[model samples]
Target: MIDTNQFLAQMQEVLEIEDRTLSPDEKFRELPEWSSLAYLSTIAMIDDEYNVIISAADFRELQTLGDIVRAISERQP
Candidate 1:
């Protein structure tokens, strides 16, 4: 099972907002650092870490951080 805390920590690192606290229901795009760069960085992080290849369209469709976690979890064993 994927650890939510570790996921959040990786997300914070990827988004370059390690100081902020992240919640599962938080809207990822609402973050101040969320941008094209952040989006691509997230995609890369998810792929490299989770071995899940999420497309740009799919990434754009994600709303909450929980949604992203579920997506990755679904892709893995």
Candidate 2:
């Protein structure tokens, strides 16, 4: 199972944020580091770290850090 800590670390790595807990209700739009480049980085990060290839549509649809965790957890190896 993909724990929340792992999710946070991955998010921090992709979004270039300090490692921290992102509450489920926290909107990603509040993060200035979030952008097209960050999303691309996130896609690569997830692929490299988890061997999960996330679609661009999926990436665009994600709203919060928890949304990403849920998406990644739903992916098959």
Candidate 3:
């Protein structure tokens, strides 16, 4: 089972977010840290941590951090 909190922490690390804690409901794209680089980093992070590869197109469709967690959870074996 993928834990949401752990996932959030990983996101914070991957996104280089340190000023504030990440919430599942937060719209990640709206964050100042969010960028093209952040998107790529997130893809790599998910692949490395969860062994799940999320394409840029699919990743772009995700609105919130919770959506990302759910996507990864659903794809995991």
Q: Pick the candidate with the highest TM-score.
A: 3
Residues 2-72, model 2: lDDT tens digits = 78787787677777667565666667767888787777787888888888887877777878878878888
Which whole-number lDDT from 0 to 100 does residue 38 have in model 2? 79
Candidate 3 residue pairs in backbone clash: none
Q: What are the clashing pairs of model 2?
A: none
lDDT of 3 by residue, 1-77 (tens): 59999999999998887888999999998998998888888888888889999776877789999999988988896
Over the stretch 7-45, how does candidate 1's per-residue lDDT look in tens digits?
A: 998999988786669999989988888988888888899
Q: For all candidates, what are the clash counts?
A: 0, 0, 0
* Span of 10 residues, lowest total lDDT, candidate 1: 53-62
- lDDT against the true structure, per candidate, is 0.86, 0.77, 0.89
Q: What is the TM-score of each candidate against the true structure?
A: 0.89, 0.80, 0.91
Global local distance difference test of model 2:
0.77
- Sorted by lDDT (best first), the order is 3, 1, 2
Q: Which residue runs does candidate 2 get wrong by more than 4 Å?
A: 19-21
* lDDT for model 3: 0.89
